[model samples]
Target: MQGVDTVLNVLGSVCLLLWGVRMVRTGLTRAFGATLRRAISACARNRFTAFAGGVGLTGILQSSTATALLLASFASRGLIPLSIALAVMLGANVGTTLTAQVLSFNLGWVSPFMIAVGVIAFLSNSSDKARHLGRVAIGLGLMLLSLHLLEAAAAPLRASPAFVAVLSGLQDEYVLAVVFAAAATWFVHSSLSSVLLVMSFASSGIIEPKLGLALIIGANIGGAIAPYFDQSTTDVDARRVPLGNLITRVVIGAGLLCFLGPIHHWLAFIDPAPARLLVNFHTAFSLVAAIVFLPLNDPLAALCRRLVPSRPQADDPGRPRHLDPNVLDTPAEALACAMRETLNLGDKVADMLRQTMDALENNDARAVKAIEAADDAVDHLYEAIKLYLVQTSRNELGEEDGRRYVEILTFTTNLEHVGDIIDKNLMELATKKIKNRYSFSAEGTAELRAFHARVLENLRLALNVFTTRDITLARRLVAEKTSMREAEMHAGDSHFARLREGRPESIETSSIHMDVIRDLKRINGHLTTVAYPILEAAGELAETRLKPSDQTLMRAPAGS
Candidate 1:
């Protein structure tokens, strides 16, 4: 019964530690995701900068796995080259060791104060950003407290014969010890947490220093494998990144295994305490990896590419390409996938609109036919996006993530409306114009073409606003809509004036010209709807674009 109690207590402490680590990673990610993404991307132009970027970002995020995914996402999207992404992963490995170093310190005295301050801040903060920071602090405090509990749990076990025998068995089969550590890491889904657990055990003499070192190596190698398997079905570019990073870890792990005796002896001489020795060795190995592997990024990337060659996109419309069902477990990642699909839908709408404009400008029947086909594709994509989002909506989502999901849905819906106008309304108008051999007057044609150009430009802007959620860009898009409306109205008056002059071409095409202009204007209206959701969310919108409908406001005073 006593043995069972010890096992339960140790398990509880480890679980607590893992939970604390998760809370910290998530809280930090939510608080600084945008800034970190921007910073990492900005520094991805060259190998050196990319390496530095990875180090800085992972240090702040405290999770190499998080940084790895970010690199993979960027590479998959063509935002960064594969080589630079590999370099970033190398640096990220080093950055993660910083947390292990911090955890190994004797900071039990600070845990209570951290918990108190974190709780107060978490309870007091009303703003979302502040609330996120508070959560980070709380997570940190819990982690420290968990370490304290871990120490207590292990201390009693150090005097147990059964515990000594287990250690003896593990020490005899270091390979088994490494496998056990790897399994534990995969379970926690965090290498840093796993290494810290090993460090705690080492400090209490529950595990030999050499065994602890083996476990840390296993933890690092296991961390790399987790991502590789997670991205098995992702794009070649994404999978390549984790594959490259995993190769680096495995290579280093193998080389370290050959020299483990010398390395352990060297580190032991420096640190008398088992906990400090384990953490120090982890940090040292990571530094060596960064130093040794940074120079080989390009070659490693090439190897990764060869290993996971990019294949042609599968011909499956029913399958959602960007919407990975597995990522729905993580709301932020799920939102990102949905957003990409939304942008893809926007691209289809843009294509249809482009063809519709060309069909009108050059009077091409084939372009009109193409617009119909493209619209069908757009509708199919919209259906896929809607269905995929529905599946992910069942998952638990944070407030901000839920809002982002709705924004994607709204954006995709507007794109569908735009596509409908181009295919159904404008396509029909183009067909009639071509069948009747009607041509606009010179001035009317130029005015219509210029207006069409501006509308196309605004569609591009709307898509950008959706992707960036940039309030400034969103405002510009809204403002451009007003300009587009004015242009539509002016083009109409210009057409009417040409008709009044009885120009032969204008008179022959009067109905087609007016109808085409109206259709394009309606398309503009749908595009403008994209900006309203963004502005309203920012509290920069009014109740209505007109005066209040209240009866009291309409009534004149009796004195007047």
Candidate 2:
């Protein structure tokens, strides 16, 4: 009964500790999300800066996995390179060790005091900054309290003859110790938790010093598996970093085993006490691995490239399947990638609109065939982006990303609608014109072609705005919307005036001409729809009425 109670108490403490870590991480990320992103994006120019950025971000968030995942997302988006990502991943490993070091100290008494202050601040009508700080304090306190409880639970096990014998059974065999530690850590799904448990056992003399050291090594290996599993759903390029990490650990573990006798002798010299020796060994292994690998990052990346050869025609012009699942772990980068895909969708729709319009004006069957093919391509992209966004939104995302995900979904739907409007409305109209052998007068064909060119140009500009988030392009697009509307009205009036003049060709083609103008106007309206969100994303449209400027309208003609 006592043993069961002890185990339950330890389990409860671990649960509390995990909860506290989560709270602190969430609070800190919310407080500094934008600042951190700006800092990382600005400072990560070289390998060294990227490494430092990774360490700094992970140290602040207290989660190496979170930092590495963010870097991976950046790499996928072409914002960061694979070599820089490797450096960052190495730094993240060092940053995560800070948590263990903090827990090693005797800070149990401060836990309740931190919780009290945290609660008071949370309850008070304080500023957001103060509340955020309070949350951090509370998380730290809970973590310490949990560590204290974990230590206490293992205290009695030191005297248990059965526990000591179990430890003795695995002490000398390095392979067995590695397997046991890996199994235990894997089952827990937390390297930190497994390390803490090893520390508890070592501190209480329930596990031998050598066995504890082996467990620490095994925990590192096991912890790496989590990240690797995360990469499984991502692109093949994304799998390289985690695979590198796994290979590094396996090779290092093997080296440690080969030189165990000398390693133990050196460890004894550094820390005479067994429990301290175990902790020191864990720290030393990480430090040594980092130092040895840091300088060889470029070569390591090259090796990964060679091992995982790039696919032939990977960049062929089509829908990209590179929205790796590993990227979903970082919401900002995921949102950015989604936006890129949306822009690609816009481009496809624009192509279809242009081809369909050309077919209608020229009565060309080839143009209709081209538009139909483009429509199929646009449909595929739309489905891909919708599915990707659905999967991405399920992960932990910032407020802006959450909103952007919805916006991307909306934008894709609008682009898809534009495609449908072309195929069903414009394409069908063109087919009818061809079937009837209806020929427009030269003047009418020229005017309709001019209008088609303007709408297509506007669609292209809207796509650029979406892709680049360019405020300048966005503003210009808004201004062009007015010109487009004017053009539609002028075209309508001219078509009616020609009919009133009793021109035989104009009267014969009056209905088709009116339909083409209306559809062109609608297509331009959807093109404008893509731009408003771009302005909103750039924060230029927030509570600001931006009227079209005359100078903006005179910048360029359609297709220029």
Candidate 3:
């Protein structure tokens, strides 16, 4: 009966420890979210920078899984290369050791204070960022307190005959200890949690220092397995980082086991205290592994490529798409990919619009036919992106990502609208030419072609802004729209002037010229609709263009 009670108590303490660690990690991620993004971006540019970024972020978040997952997300999106990702993963292993250091200290009394402050901040009407920070502090405090409880629970087991016997058996059989440690880490889904438990046993004298060190090493290796498996279905490039992480740990673990004697001797010199000695050894092992593996990142990446060779039709459009539903687990990253696809849709639509316009002006029925077919392709892309966004919204997303999703949906919808407008409006004009037997004069055709060129330029610029989110390009779009409006006004005035000059042949041509000018102006208006939303989403839209002129320069040609 006493043994059952002890088991239950240990289970409860472990649960609290896991919960506390989750809370702390979540809070820290929320508090420094922007900085984390910036760090990721900065690290992507260079291998060394990426390693530093991974270490710093994992140190702040206190979770290697989170860092590993983030790296996978970046690689899947093509934001960072596989070599840099491997470096980052190596650094993350070192960073996760910080949690063990924190748990080793006697800080149980600080738990209540952390809870109080965190709860108050969480419940307060303060900024969301502040509340997030408070939650992190509280979680850290609780984790420390749980460690204290775990130590106390194990303290009783230390003097028990059965418990001592179990510990002695684990110590003598290194293989059993390694297996036990791996199972504990896998079961808890956190290396830090497993390490804390092992550290508690060590501090209470339930396990020898050597066995504890071995278990800690095994836990690190085990914890890495989950992330690697999780990343298996991601991009081929992304799989390399987790694969490298797994290999590094396995190699290091094997080396440590073979040289267990020297490892213990080296630890004794650093710290004679058993618990501290174990912690120091754990830290040292990770740091050394990071340094040793850092230089081999490129070769590791190459090996992963050879092992998980890219398929023959990997980049083929018809190949089974690689966009996994699991990616939606990270909403921000999912939205970014969605946006990229949306931009692709925009480009297709723009091309269709240009081709349709050319077909109309040049009287090429085949181009009109091509435009109609392209519209169907745009429809397909729209459906895919819309479905993706719907799935993304179901996940827990950050505020920025949520808004970006909304913006992308809006932009895609507007692009679709532009496609519809081009196909329908230009087709109507084509019908007019066939039905009324109306053929523009040479002068009218020339003017219409000039107007078509201007409108197509605007469409291209709008698509560019969506693709790159280039503020400079967005501003240029606004400027072009302004210039287009002025050109339309000048053309209208000039046509009126020519009408009164007593040239009867000029009358029919002038009306067609005016129609072409109006259509061009209206196309630019829709293009602006696409541009402004992207600029606004980027928070780069100028204040002057916030409330864009509702008075479009093109009216509906006075009801046909």
Candidate 4:
């Protein structure tokens, strides 16, 4: 019963450690995420500054994996050079050891006071940023508190036969112990939590000093593994950063394994406290990794590039370039990626619109064929965007983020439908005109050309509105919808007048000319739909265009 209780108590402590670490990470990220991200990005001007930036960010957040993931996203976007990004990952490994170093201190007394102050500030503060900082304080307190609890939980192991036997097994099976810790860290996705537990175990005499060092080495290796797994679906540039970090860990971790015997002997003679032994090893290992790998970043990065050579995507523009899966954990970044991809998709549709018009004017079969080809690319992007968005954590998104998500999805869907209209309807119209060699009458040609120009102008405006989300421009787009309707009506009337005058070409092609006019108007209508959500969100859209029913009910004043 005592053994079972001891195991349960240790398990609970582990959970508390993880929760506290999570609170710190999420709180810090929520509070200063954007500024910190920019700092890292800007530091990429040089490999050394980039390295410092990684260390600084992970030192604050206490998670090097998070740093790696953020850098991976920047690399995926082509914003940061791959070499600089890999250097950041090297520094992140060193930064992660900060937690282990801090935990090694006897700061348990700080926990209760910090928790009290944190709760007071968190509850009293009105600003989200302040609250997030308060949350960070609370997480720090809990981490300290959990370490205290972990010390107490291991107390029972002092007398338990089962615990002693387990420790003995670990002594003989040190390699297996390393593997176990590595696997556990990978499962939890946190090396800090795992290493701290090993430190706690060693502090309480539940594990040998040599065993503790082995586990810490494993924790480092496992920590790098999770980020690599996360970036599996991203582009080679993104994957390469994590891959380079993993290689550093593997090489260093392997070397550390052989030296553990001698290091343990030397450290035990120098300062024999088991907890310090475990944590100091972790810190030393990481710092060495940073120092050794920092200078080799270029060669390492070159090697990574060679390993994960860029698959030339010149032919696959439809493939999503901005949707780095690593950043999906950061909702705002992911949404921004989706928005950029939408703009790219919109550009494809714009190309189609221009091509179709050129095909009409020049009687160019190739231009019409280009429109058809571009539509397929548009369809590819739409599916990729949908699937990419579906991967985002819906429940985690904020209110504005949720709204933006729907807007992006709706905009992409509308763009896809627009692509269909161009390929299926407009292409057929162009094909018919060219195959039958039915040229429009001069008056008819002039009207169709004018209508096509207006529609194309609106298409350009809609793209700007989608990208900038300028409510005034969106308002302009909505207003122009009515004007476009008026113009379409006028053009239709003009076509009939030409037909009724017994103009032979107009009479002969009356059906085709009117159909072309109707289709262009339809395209303009589709372009206008992009503005509806923007207007509705801004509270500028009226429920009905009709005057209030009360005006009708009361009747005009008798004076009128």
* lDDT of candidate 3 over 352-428, digit per residue (tens): 86686566566677887888778777777788888888987885566667767777888788787877777777666
Stretches of candidate 2 off by over 4 Å are 1-12, 23-58, 73-88, 116-135, 152-173, 183-190, 259-275, 295-299, 316-341, 363-373, 376-409, 431-438, 457-514, 525-560
Q: Where does model 1 exceed 4 Å of error?
A: 1-4, 42-49, 155-166, 312-344, 350-380, 383-407, 414-560
Stretches of candidate 3 above 4 Å error? Answer: 1-8, 40-51, 76-81, 153-169, 314-340, 346-560
lDDT of each: 0.81, 0.75, 0.76, 0.84
Span of ten consecutive residues with least summed lDDT in model 3: 314-323
**Per-model TM values vs. the true structure:** 0.69, 0.74, 0.65, 0.86
What are the clash counts of all predictions, listed in order?
Answer: 0, 0, 0, 0
Clashing pairs in 3: none
Among the numbered candidates, top lDDT falls to: 4
Ranking by lDDT: 4, 1, 3, 2
lDDT of 4 at 247: 93
> Model 1 over residues 1-560: C-alpha lDDT tens digits?
87777888888988888777777777777667667878988888888888888888888778888788877777787888999999888888888888778878988888788778777887897765676777778778888988889888878788789888888888867677777877777767789888888888888878887888888889998888788877787789889998998898878877886777888889979987898988898888787888888888888988988999878875753345687553544567778888988888887787777777678867899998888888888888889888888877875466887888888888888888888888888888888888887777778888778877778888898888888888899888888878877887788788878878889998888888888777777777777777787789889887877865668566867775
Candidate maximizing TM-score: 4
Error of 2 at 67 (Å): 3.9
- The positional error of residue 8 in candidate 1, measured at the CA in angstroms, is 3.7
